[model samples]
Target: MVASSTTDAELSPTVRVLDPEGRDIRFVSALDPAGVVAHGWLRASHRAPDAERTLPYRPWHPHGRLDPLTPGAAVPLDIEIWSTSVVVDPAGHRLAVTVQGRDFEFPGEDPWPRSYGVDTKGHAIFLHDDPDDRPTSVFGGVTT
Candidate 1:
């Protein structure tokens, strides 16, 4: 893993992707100055073992492939996050994630910025919002 020089004050909570064996495959932070906002490991469906075992409805491409974080490997991923939403682009092998502002204060009366994710096609996936009691869905389409 590349060492980060950013301090806690400059770093936002990170979203991590782990392999099937629970190994850290890749991670991304919104705090990055480069606008790298998000990234994760990916592989073509044909390269993945038993791809049909999960989510049979999704289509897989035999020629598609995502560059592995490691030099050479086919890694399956499990996504995890503390306070962000992630969107995957299966065909493009990309991940887009939401990141709350570093100044955001939770469980307080003050207003804070909201964070959200977008799919490869640019559809919104809401992540953070005030009034925590409101019912919501992760798959909820863009709200007006």
Candidate 2:
């Protein structure tokens, strides 16, 4: 019998949020950076229903108030993209990020100012206001 194999790119990648206890958190969508500069946002598609069957639904507020380090303070979380994950720590010195099993670390710095929230349908929505001159949507050639 012939054997078949698949590369990391061929497989569908998943974006996951892990709580401090290492438990997976359920989210509708996530903001995927278009590039290193964070000029725009790319909608991340949720995994197939079969893949998410085992995951539990846990709501999280990304815009909640944050306090300095303390015993009961906000828990640090790790955002996983595909085979890689990054421990998101505001006070950490290094930002670890891996994509498709490739290391992509950078110096810890302030993140871009962008708004995101969950929609009525429980889908994560990234609020991006395009410039007046730029096209609103990538398809249909629609412009502002």
Candidate 3:
């Protein structure tokens, strides 16, 4: 994996995407909080096995694929937070996630701007890219 110098203070909602084996598929540094990509045009990307998925915006892709607003596209949550619910939008194509720690804080100014880790439990939803796209797997070790 490419060593990323980007920090968490710059990111609004940060998070990490882990595989079923508990390996980090990718890191989403800015989208960790509840308000980051909650609205507007954004992207979300991920890879599961050989599939690399990318969404252009939120509210579900009209061409089909992943539509969180759609009835069937809702990824069942095995985790929850704040008594509130969140869904993965079909529009946002996740790219990279930010790691926790560092000297940055959300909703605050910083000497060095960076992204923060998002709540990766129930909000940790992403699209599994299908074949025909690049299929190299990216992995990260577990951290508490």
Candidate 4:
């Protein structure tokens, strides 16, 4: 997550599983270019990890209460991409992880922004292009 869009908001975004051929690798769903490998949601103010429940590989958020964020607060989040086993072709296949925003759209794909987070009209059903969740002022900077 970049920065808090509001005092308290719900952030729901999907991590796309990509293939070398410009296609989202999908095992299910009939939606075109649907390669949603992992998805998770957490309140902007409820990102604290549960010490007892969190593991080395997976993080557990207590979600017991809300701790709203200060506007423009840069928050660090731990998003887990479910473990997966993939055999890549030696020719040109590659396994990589890239953090994507809502501006990305494939050819012939829906042009509208589609995100159902706190405040959204629901544009591209699966594409995570919610302006409310991603403010250019926050995401545009280089993160360490």
Candidate 5:
């Protein structure tokens, strides 16, 4: 008799948004289909209490040049992926997703989230609700 085992690496890159099983993950973003497709970055961090770690991406406006996401140095439990096309609906609006699986959603009218910011020069930056923390630059490269 022979025994075989399948590893995580053996699975396909395409993630099933909705599975027959109950296991699923959720994400929030206001990015439209094009924006999501262009700059979709997800990550999981203790810093983010609610959002699990996922890949990271940048959002770009329509008719604008797309920017590459700044890669993190740490390894993730799952592989990081970038989208090739921003899925859209018949109305031409960015398809909003809010499923309990590995998908993204837009939280319209919700409070701002705590996130790290990066500048063009590639410096680390944090957001502060208080005016006191406001500085000349968001990061070394991004000046507010």
Candidate 6:
């Protein structure tokens, strides 16, 4: 199993399954029906953990506080991957854990129905289209 980040501002928080019957994994994005499994990430400033609620599998963070990032410095950030139920057959399918800069989208027509009242295409209602907020930025870049 191999995983890596393409940028400094990447989301990461791993998982462990002790199931005696255990055998698989993948790079699934959150809300991606392609094979929805689990995903999570926290803003760098919101990485403060709630010590009392922290656990081995899941690390809880309190959003009440914000910590500014130090330029050109590396910091540890904890993430929480929302759990899901999926059956994976290692022999037939390869598990892919995607760690990318943007949200995942359906290449063709949206398989999700709009009448259902959710993002049939991709992304939440955050509507990060405002250029002023710099929706297209990354860490250690001129933008971000």
Candidates' C-alpha lDDT: 0.29, 0.26, 0.26, 0.51, 0.25, 0.47
Residue 19 error, candidate 3, Å: 22
Q: 63-87, model 1: which lDDT tens digit per residue?
A: 3453323323324433223344655
The local distance difference test score of model 3 is 0.26
* Model 4: per-residue Cα lDDT at residue 123: 15
Cα lDDT tens digits, model 5, 1-144, are 101121111111222232234322222334221122222222121112213333344222232232222322232223234454433333423332321212233334433333343221110121122334322232122101
Against the hidden reference, what TM-scores do the models get? 0.16, 0.18, 0.17, 0.54, 0.17, 0.59
Model 1 residue 90 distance off true place after TM-score fit, in angstroms: 8.6
7 Cα displacement, candidate 3 (Å):
22
- Candidate 4 versus the native: TM-score? 0.54
Across 23-140, the per-residue lDDT of candidate 6 in tens digits comes to: 3332334443332355455556567899999998888987888665554556676677777666654454544455443443334554553423656343332233345543344343
User: Could you tell me which 10 consecutive residues in candidate 3 have the lowest summed lDDT?
Assistant: 2-11
Q: Flag clash pairs in model 2.
A: none
- Model 5 earns a TM-score of 0.17
* Candidate 5: segments with Cα more than 4 A from true spot: 1-8, 15-76, 91-144
Task: State the displacement of the C-alpha of residue 128, model 3, in Å, after optimal TM-score superposition.
Answer: 35
Stretches of model 1 off by over 4 angstroms after superposition = 1-15, 32-82, 87-144
Q: Candidate 6: deviation at residue 57, Å?
A: 0.4
State how far residue 105 of model 6 sits from its true place (Å): 2.7
Judging by lDDT, tell me the better candidate of 1 and 2: 1
Q: What value of lDDT does candidate 1 attain over all alpha carbons?
A: 0.29
What is residue 37's positional error in candidate 3, in angstroms? Answer: 8.6
